[model samples]
Target chain A: MPDEAPNDPKPSAEDSPAKGPGNPAREQEPAAQAASEPEARAAEVIERERRGPSGEPVRSVTFAERKRMNRRELLKLVPLIAVGAVAIPAFRQPILNQGLRFSDWTAGALFGRHRLAQTYSDREVAPFEKFPYNFYDVADPGVDLEKWTLTVSGLVQRPGDYKMDQIQAFPKVVQNTRHVCVEGWDVIGNFGGTRASDFLRWIGADPSARFLEVTCVDGYYESIDMATVLHPQTLFCYEMYGKPLDRGHGAPLRLQMPTKLGYKQAKYLDSIKVTNVLLSDMRGYWEDQGYSWYGGL
Target chain B: MAATVAVVKQKPEETTTVVYEHPLVVRIAHWLNAVALLVMIGSGLRIFLAFPSFGPRIPQQNFFVLPPRPLTIGGWLGGALQWHFTFMWIFVGSGLLYVVYQIVTGHWRQVLFLPRDVKGLWPMARHYFLFSPKPVVDAAYNPLQKLAYTSTIFFGVVSTLTGIVMYKPAQFWWLAWPMGGYHFARSWHFFAMLGFVAFIPGHLLMVAIHGWNNFYSMITGWKREPEYLE
Candidate 1:
């Protein structure tokens, strides 16, 4: 509202000199009258003398010269048309998924990896009802704390399953950040976790690996890019809002990715598989259906 | 006086004259806008379809319908978002340049709506509806065109603001508050997109009605005209 245009008199087309015969005032203007007489005389002379090759002057003006989309212009459009034809299908999900990768690279480069996600204070937390809870499964199949373990495999030097205590034994980080959903809502939560970078390093994850494929206990699988996996804010969350995570909140372990959508933060994380393999479609659960794979800010 | 006088037939020679309607910068900006807006709308629809409603319940009276599976840009939400945010720069950058150029060059005076233009709205509408001859105004744009072009700018601002708020509610929380909240801002963003999409068809139809010279003017920045004296 503050940016509303200031009230100013605009010059409409009708305000132009001599819109039509209906404007008697414009016709009576001495300046307009003075200007029109010579123009009218010139028009009369041109009308009489001007002729096509056959000798009759054109009555209604035809923009034959200007209207034509000449061959040069038509040729110029061919490359554009071809690019559009290719880009149309290329941008879609399954086939020719080349464009998304380019878009990803461009956005990733523009908003560099170091650029931090916005943090928030307790007072700014989104209202409770606005907070969304999304998961792959119909019910939260509560994990047994005594038996559950996080398995690290693939290109990691330390390829083994570790109990919660063993995982929590590492350094912990606490962050208060906004969790944005792909469905267009947001919620703020305090997450306590170990820095994923530290954990990956602790486990000796292959630095050269292109992807870190994570599978949740709920059968949800997602492939994350190395740059995002090592993002400073990316966490292997164990606690939410101070207390340990509840059953519905991915109790044992969850990936808290502030840079990504809620869906990208795979819950009840069961395993982390670091690999150099780049799948044709590196999509998460929702992404495979039609959600964007790179749901970053 | 007799020698100077010349008789004219049914159609006058006024149309033979040529007018420089669209300037070079304006033409470039116009085409860039067309491409950017189309991509935004298509990918935006993909984003919208994911949630598809303002609230938990779907709207009872659904009018605008996309295909069961339209050939949308940006494959998925992540892909669509990349496309959306990437082209967002193009949209915003060009839009800012266009607006700044218009204001700096005094072209805003010709396009911006004013109280005076209201008086001509009905007449212009009548001219279109009743098939009456177009009034030959010596300005760059007619009253109706001025209104449409001006409103599009307003909608563009709305879309941009709402989009930013939705993108980062905590960062732009102040902007989100006036829109009622984050979800409301998203809804408003969707509505703004709808407003823009609705405007496109009407705008294209008008261009078609105005003939090839009108369309060519946007591309070549030149319009063949008639220097008619009423």
Candidate 2:
């Protein structure tokens, strides 16, 4: 801090600061001479700090003054702190309780919907006809195939722009399995149509595409990792339980995965995209706030 | 009323004292708070990462960067649930005891919240911002501290209640009903987590800025500078 040479021994003249008031000692000197003429008395006035150097007796007067001052200060600080300490616990309990509550219920609740998952005693697993159910003949709601075409895009090699027939043409494999919803529910159903793996393979799922994002006819959309999409149970089912797929059950085409929770099971499938990406500023349907993306059973 | 006579006496020098401030028990509690809060944040993140509960989610597309630890200490999700609840109770318990101790010992008023201090908040803020050395000095709990600590407590209690509502929905359905149901409880819970996330870094920075050494008094139980005790 000394602009003057480093060797400067003292506060340079320019930096000279004013000292404290003088002459107080002179007043004490007069009092000392008048009151205590004896050398021992003078010695007593020259009060050595009552707090001894290391360990020695000190006068109770000085010790008492110091002790009293400290106790007063501590006393003051204590009450002030004490006043506020009262409310702290009342506040803390609520915070902990809230955090744990929702987290506890979410996983079980969302997983409940998996019962509707397409299951086949058919396919490679078993024969569906062997179940020996009387077939209920119902007229087709007759969804126009010409007007229907599935659009798929995202981080993929060739995004799918194909028809129902086009998807049907892709070495179709259907599996009947249970659909589990994270909401603590389940459904068992039959599925017939293109497998997500076959569709992904047909599209030559891009090497970089780590997630499979599916958008439904409703504005709701869900994105899943390629691993889950490619799981043996996932399906882009076109038919359900001996009938043209009902629209209510994510008809036309829908995703049916036994392993994943219900929300991961996209319904009314419309658009598909493959990408190793996520919607940063987005939360889809149930996932808008708390639902987990994994949705694994 | 009685004096603790000084064991050591110095010859002809000014007498001064460095009084005992924080006791060992108090200091231990303080440090526990620091450690517990750290774990709470770290494990809290783990719990939150479980499903991106509440809002503002980060998509886990890159498994390599945010590798899945899955936090499966036990077989199922219940393991994490139990761990978080256990930690939460510890944190809550420590804070509860500390409050009771401070209040019983008459230290809480000085360290935490107060009525007059509430009035002094604006002046305290202005003095700090303006860099005025002549700051308002009362007995304790500067107005700013009162408000902050008070808010912290307020937030803490509300959050805990909402947490209970969400936690045992069937059990505490009555409480959640006023907040519009479990959904709102989830929303409040999310907001409270945000509050803690925001509070911690700022609290640490303030402690550092003011003086980390002074802050150490909470650990040492005594200020090194005797004049401060005065």
Candidate 3:
């Protein structure tokens, strides 16, 4: 194929390194330096006609060079083989974690923060009988219901423990959305709770706080991005299927964020610590092991 | 007269031709896609191991057995997802760019299979399987090649669309609904990767049979040819 650049004057100039004044190969051609466009065109045509169909210069490869190439090709496989030898076991998590912050930044840029998770009608919600035991790390420790309080701390003016009634007093928003697990199972359910954005606003949370550090009763801790924390679908959920969350479910409280994978929706009522800086050492129980921290969709 | 004689003497004796089999963009996209597919398959296998069975956990073995645990990328589900979501963009970007390049350069004519190619497919298949007689090949690709390439492109499109469905099923319910809901989309995504796994060995074998020169063309965008009789 003819070079596309030859027709486009700008690209022909940009592409040819020899066009530069400092090019050593052209330094001897003082007369050629002053050569006009027609001369250059003629030279280009001559060079083009001399080349083969693919624009590659026809050349002779000696037997010795071809012999050496076999070894060279074998040598090329060395790094890939080395990576295969020790990629996952030795540095799986570390290598996966590398450039994760950048990945998150790119995802944020591409997907944007304001986009909402898809919602379904109440009828589309899957029946509980079909697929049970969907979530992992289920913990329902005995607790005094009256004495239980949902604590809100860190980067908030109203940073104090509030009773279940106090939490319930806030206006409720009901959503029928699919809960997608990282393990590749999903179910639609009717989740009722205060919108997370509203809750963040109600708590007088600092707008500048970048993350929400959530701790569960089972010692399961996870940090969610502020964008997700303030997502319209993200909820401090307490009701499932139009009833108060049962013991098997996260009673009194659980995060019902459809945008995230199942693991990110931490069950069990616990303290929420909002902060500007992310946890440097630990991100989450699963995230520390190598999971993408964002877990969006 | 002396300079002309010297130039003639300096020229090599062997008359050879080099065909530009691939453009620079195609070459770059080809390798980018290879790396992207490798990373995706590795991490996707890890993701699959998180829940090996479809319905519920059953100990009984089926026809398809997964590679050993260590061979798999499933040490950590989170880590696997990390690798999967990250490299997914690279796969999407490179694949789309390749399609765009083909369309823009009118290279799709050489790749996309037409009804007329069906007549040629049987002969190509017979040549490969029966070892009857080698059929005349095209300068770029054969009919069988066009069919395979076109199907693989379809596979890639489905894989990416299924990925989106899995990623945000709730957000992209319209996409998931046509695929028979979330679970179906997941299965489709898994199977598409399997299609890639199946396609790769056959692709490599063909390249091997075509010789190292064929493989080298992808890297350097040039193919070696003997001098033709005018």
Taking the tens digit of each residue's C-alpha lDDT, what string does model 1 give over A1-297? 011111111233233243212433532342343365643332312121222221212122222432332233434344433324435555433332454555456545544467577777878765443455565257687778678899999998889998888778878888888787776645677889988898999899989887888888878878788888898888999988777877788888999888776878888889889998856555577667645566565
Question: Compared with the true structure, what per-residue lDDT tens digits does model 3 show for residues B30-70?
Answer: 77688878888887877787777554332323226775667
Model 1 chain B, TM? 0.83
After superposition, which runs of candidate 1 have C-alpha atoms over 4 Å from their true positions? A1-96, A112-116, A123-132, A136-142, A154-157, A205-211, A281-283, A288-290, B1-15, B20-32, B35-39, B52-137, B164-184, B201-205, B208-222, B227-230
After TM-score superposition, the amount by which residue A158's alpha carbon in candidate 1 deviates from its true location, in angstroms, is 3.6
Ranking by TM-score: 3, 1, 2
Q: What are the candidates' interface root-mean-square deviations? A: 12.3, 15.5, 8.0
Clashing pairs in 3: A54-B20, A118-B170, A118-B171, A290-B79, A291-B78, A291-B79
Write one digit per residue (lDDT tens) for candidate 2, span A184-256. Answer: 2233456677778888888777855677877776666887766667765567888776676665555688787
Rounded to one decimal, what is candidate 1's iRMSD? 12.3
Regions more than 4 Å wrong, model 2: A1-297, B1-16, B53-82, B178-180, B226-230
Instruction: Give the winner by TM-score: 1 or 3.
Output: 3
Q: Rank the candidates by lDDT, best first.
A: 3, 1, 2
Model 2 scores a C-alpha lDDT of 0.53
TM-score of each: 0.67, 0.40, 0.77
Local distance difference test scores for all models: 0.65, 0.53, 0.68
Candidate 3 — number of clashing residue pairs?
Answer: 6
Give the worst 10-residue stretch by lDDT in candidate 2 chain B: B55-64
